[model samples]
Target: MLGSMAIRALSLSPLDSIAVVVHPDDPLDWLPALGNSAFSASPSAWPSIQVVTCTEASQGMSFSIRCGLKALIDDNPKLDAVVVVLADQPFITTGMIAELIGYLSERPELDYVATATDVGGEGEQNAILMPPAILSRSMFEVLLQLEGDAGARKLFGLPQFRGAALLAADRTTVFDVDTPADMVLATKQILGQTYIREHRF
Candidate 1:
């Protein structure tokens, strides 16, 4: 349900399709909002989401990404492009999703694109976006063979794949639900502070 809500709040357009890759063992607390977002999104142009859950999801993020990418390519061999998103990022509103899709739609020449917020640091800020371009099926196969916790860093470095990082106006776009504290915060945002106290703890 948490992921569904994430989908509903996304800025979806007629031009793009989204592939939501979730871990089979995703926390129960995150379900309601995600499900709500996905089901509540504008039905007319609602993205075709392929829920790819793998047993190896317990392995790492890369496994999940590879599973999702493989599913997307296998199901829709002609998939033009896909927005690789995280189900746990509750703050990413639908408007942000639309903006990213819109930017990519206007410029098809770019292999892939991502949105990031500046996390103030010493010299420069850290940029985070969905990794590894999902341009071709061959690229996805290569991703499936990848190992460890790395998402798609090496794949993006290849000459054939090009990417762009959009500076997010709202930094909340970069907040990802990765730990117990993150779950508590996300639950409050989705189900409200009062609800958390009354139900989720």
Candidate 2:
């Protein structure tokens, strides 16, 4: 998942860092130990990661969000913005992340830039804001207030985030990977597109 997420900052700058917030007992055992850990020590590959254990993760998504943001803040006091992309959304592309960053950078008046897919039944559709969002430093404190099971998108509708913007993303690019069946379908989607691209040459 991390391999697919190395996106350059806006202006083609180096993608500085990434901090993965894992539960203390999460199965991804290879994560390194080098943050303000809430758990004991244990020690990865490209981009060089530092795992931040969210002991209060069970409390809600807010805790995890706060934990991850705190780690980033501690590391880079001058952080411009942050892109909160979920690991399950492996199909998220670098171009998508860059757009979020670039758009937010261009509009300092905005609190965040978010991606949304058209979701609806039958032939109707509506833009439903989702993650893989880029939020300016101004929005970090608001994110800390998110509650149980609430995602970062929760704050998008609030009065404080009035100037937030949304970018439409293709549905397939945000295909969620929550189940084995979903993984199978995502693999087929990737491979099918690869096959088509290769033969088109």
Candidate 3:
């Protein structure tokens, strides 16, 4: 999943850099493998690619997010914004990423741009506010305040960030793989197979 996500991210023409964050207890040597594979597959993208390791991954998702954001900022201080992409979201495409960046670029007044889905009468919900989303440098402080399992979505509730949020035109791009069933669904979607509904216990 990580490898596929990395390849797709690196393939984007709008992005100048890519960061892959790995947890300390990832079991596999994903960092080196990802680096090697990326270099082998796309030598030009390799230099811009960075593998970040989060020693405090056990601390939760916020730690990993902090680690990756810090690494990207440190690597390129001139960067105007950072796009947070999760490895588990295989369905995310280069076009979606570019769309986020392009939307933010066209609207300098916005602080952040994220993908959202309309949940029927429930109104719209932030699909993930991630990977395919863009966060300006001004929001770094707010992002750093996140902790535990919390994510950037927490900012959505804050008054200061509410009005600045811009939703992407496409909502389906936010789908991600969070469980075995999700992986199956993703595979089925990718292969154009008909979904087989199953009851869960």
Cα error, residue 91 of model 3, in Å, equals: 0.6
Query: lDDT (CA) for every model shown?
Result: 0.61, 0.68, 0.68
Clashes of 3: 2
RMSD of each: 5.4, 7.3, 6.2
- Candidate 3 lDDT tens digits, 1-201: 445554555455477887778776666544455445433345555437766889997778899899988898898887788887767776676677777778888888777887666545344442334455678887889888788988877775576763243454555456778888887877777555222323333
| Weakest ten-residue segment in model 1 by summed lDDT | 129-138
Error (Å) of candidate 3 at residue 106 is: 1.3
For candidate 2, list the clashing residue pairs, or say none.
none
Off-target runs (Cα >4 Å) in candidate 3 are 27-42, 45-47, 121-131, 162-172, 193-201
lDDT of 2 at 56: 85
Off by over 4 Å in 2: 1-14, 27-48, 120-125, 193-201
Which ten residues in a row are the worst by lDDT in model 2?
5-14
**Mind giving the per-residue lDDT tens digits that candidate 1 earns over 1-201?**
446555555435443555666666755465345344334454565556545668787788788777777787787788766666666665666666666667777877776666655566422247655521234333555567788776765566678776676776766555778899988877766667447667873
Compare candidates 1 and 2 on lDDT and give the better one.
2
For model 2, what is the alpha-carbon lDDT of residue 137? 86
